[model samples]
Target: MSRHLLLGVALLAALHSAYAGGKVLMLLQSEKNIDRFSSFTDALTAAGFTIEIKGYKDSSLKLREYGTWLYDDLVLFAPKAEGFGGSIDQQTILDFVDSGHNVLLGVNSDVSEAMRNLAAEFGVDLDDRGTKVYDHFHYAVKEDGKQDHTLIAATDLVDSPVMVGGPYKQPILFRGLAASVPSNSELATVVLSAPGTAYSHDPKKSMIEPPALMVGAAASLVTAVQARNNARMVVAGSVEMFSNDIFNSQVTVNGASTATANKDFCVTLTRWAFQDRGVLVASNLRHHLLGSEEQPWGYRVNDDVEFLVDVMEHEGGVAKPYKADDIQLEFIMLNPYVRVPLQHDGQGTFSLRFKVPDVYGVFKYFIDYSHRGYSYIKLTHQVPVRPFKHDEYERFLVCAYPYYASAASVMAAFFALGFFFLYHK
Candidate 1:
């Protein structure tokens, strides 16, 4: 009976693992070859994600009907989406993603206006319908020994481990459009960028008359944004990179040819987007008196307090501390009264010691960390601040002895003068 029970428990655990794997919802073009995404699907499956693909025609505006919450990620790869059917408009998808779910958005030259509008709403400025990004000088050479100027070899990857993770074996292939993210957007960060020789224009048009709309490093080939709620969105200018041919293609620059980084790039990108990696989870936050780990409902002014947080970064498996650098802490009233750098001891715990300000009021310990390509981390702990106790006040001070003596002498003289005046009267 014990053996049977153990077997039953093991079976249940396997079933749970299958159900708990990341689920994906992909909206693709019905006209395109479905086999084109065979490798993409395989990669996702290898990463433990179950994918569900539906054509725009079949997709419904009623996203809840398809269990949006049930899915962990959404991939919008419909470049030629003329219009969405049912109630699944741009806002519907955005609202779904805004609920702390992730999305991987891909666009092309034939990108529909609806898709462009959606990109704009996310602060991603995509090029016009017919325009494309090209590097006149750095274009990849084709297998035919001819330069394909339109197939740009983008080498400017952002220096972020949470995004790219490791050294890419080769540059990613960008054969599509370009975009720009709002400069003021704290959530948006460029993941891939075109080289200084790149420009955006309509290939069919006369190039001599029109200036390049986007030039140099200003052209954003790919970008990612982490919303205030820690939801991530990865926007790519090209969908071809996910195709099997491109994923396996060799990149030729000048006279040299080597295997491309397309496959690794896409897989890593998906992992980051799905929050399997580059996700920071702060838990088990504890703050108390420096010496006594005792936590009180409130704290006294001028007390030395200590703050500690267990900050772990999530990657496919167990979460561990992202002990990269100094995290920040702020003691805030109406305004920030104290700001200090948190130190970690090579463990998951981050801590800092600071003296409570003499001025007492309601305050909060605020920790806001905005790491690019990672989820936003904001923690606020409220603890009221009370003034020092009556006994806490100084009874005597060497510096103030002169002032106390002068006050005593003035009182003595006042009494003498009062007696003299009474007697004379």
Candidate 2:
């Protein structure tokens, strides 16, 4: 009986895992060969995702059914499609992301205007329609002793482990257009940028212009955006990078040949875009007296208070304690009264003990944490801080002793005067 019960429990667990895996809607072009991305699709399948492949021009495609999103993620692989068919337009894509769903958008040299506008919304500026990124010095060498400068061997990856499971040992092979992300953009970040020798221009034309539209390291090959709502989007310059050929290709840099890291990078990029990694959630926010577990209705000025919160990061559908050294807590009114770093117990419980500010008013406990490649956590808890009661004031203030002495002298003088008057009478 025990064995049967265990089997039933295991079956239920399997069902739960299957359902928890998200559904993805991949929009591709009928002309583009889907089999080329088998490796990428297989990886997603291994990660327990259900993929629904549809042509971008499929008029029956519906992202929403009865005002509800039917898919957890969207993949745009049809760069040449002028516009999505049916109800899926640029605004539809934006609304999907605005609703906190993830997107992985890919574009090529033939990128369409609709795709460009979508990328623009995410702060990714793609090069002109016919322009392709060319790296004269970093082009992949063909067996015929010719180099196609458009096929760039990009090694300038963003220095973020949470973003691109990094420390890439080899260059990623890219063949497509280039994009430019604003250096000062807070929402968008460059995941892979063209090498210093690379530039974006018309590959069919000669060099008459000195500065290309996107020159050298400024030409971003891949970018990722983490929206304020924590919706993630990754824009790839070359959709071919996710193909099996690139995944299995070898690149010769200098005198040595090594396998391309496109497969690993693409997998990591998709995982991040889908929120399977670097997703943080903060909960159990609590603040109270230093030694008390129960929170008071309100705090008193100058009270030693402790604030605690549980921070967890989701990976492979499992929540684990989030580890970081920079999470901070702020006690705020109009401005921050106290801002201090939160210390974690290695078990996800972050705590900070601070004295409430002497200023008494309605104050809020605020936490605003934004990390590159990670979900943004913004939390605010409002609480009032009361001043001391009149009876709670100190009995004998040193500053008031002079006044007390003066009053005492006045009373003594009156009594002495009264005694003199009575004796004389």
Candidate 3:
């Protein structure tokens, strides 16, 4: 019946709705394969997302119509389309990412100039001549000594729980040929690579000069870009790598003669690409003195303060947050004055309590927490530390106070003796 109570109830409902809602949109070119699109859509949906697939050929489709807000996420599976069917062109897609939304670009051996241009925009150089990757030493071998270089098996994956599947039961090995450059961009992180034995070339023709790009030294298979704005993008050299057939296929690597399923690798790669595994989120951040209820505007020299942050996976389940030993903190000015490991409280909180240094100046509590499969967490809280106040100084030093009293008494004695001597004389 009260207006204030009604307002409070309305605010709670709005908060809940915002937290519980999210959508995924897929934009495809006319020639895009139905199977690949369907598989990706199904995976996202199974992950509890509401997905909508649209074709660029649709007459009503226009990137400008949506302006800066087309979709929360975009999937570009139509690499061969010379241009988008909608008003959305290459520039429009770039703008979408610039505005902070996720994008997935899947390029196969049949990479087009348009696809290469897009990859270049993201600082990736796909071999223009359509070179297939070949690894004689690491390729899948048959009964004969010759290697099956076409369907090469790669297991030299980046040892990142976030990039690869978490603690794979068996090694995730893939038998396919894809080309990528070495991990070079400061903004991008490489997830998969061709083994040291692998190299890219025109597999149809015989070698002329030593291959242009060497394996292990100059190629990547799968690379992920996490922009400064936290917009995520995955660039893969092969699209069929995520197909149901490849996902379910099994292979053997090295001396393991028996062939096993390669489904694990496919599943792991998909999870990493679709934002499944490595999703670090900031839970709680706080700063306060050791024994006070109040959080001060600044700290005092040698004051003990506790810095805490709770990190957890974004997906809901029974997963635990960062363990007691899994977090770290930095007391930084320009560089870190102190880089200390945080102890967890056994609950969800990872915290560190340390005394402020006697030095006084502007300093920041910084935590750059990036786990392998999670989103990166960066936090900085600035607070200045002042020299101790006069009243706050230690009281009545035994040695110094005695010295002060003796000096005062000596002065009084000299004055009294002078007065007496003058009067007596």
lDDT of all predictions: 0.81, 0.88, 0.66
Indicate the TM-score of model 3.
Answer: 0.81
What CA RMSD would you report for each candidate? 4.7, 3.7, 4.3
- Structural similarity to truth (TM-score) of each candidate: 0.87, 0.92, 0.81
TM-score of 2: 0.92
The regions of model 1 sitting more than 4 angstroms off are 1-21, 59-62, 66-68, 209-212, 403-425
**On residues 95-201, what C-alpha lDDT tens digit does candidate 1 reach at each position?**
87788888899888888888888888888989888998878878787676767788988778889877876588687888888898766878788888989988889
Count of clashing residue pairs in every prediction: 2, 0, 12
> Of the candidates numbered 1 and 2, which has the greater lDDT value?
2
Q: Which ten residues in a row have the lowest lDDT in candidate 1?
A: 12-21
lDDT of 3: 0.66
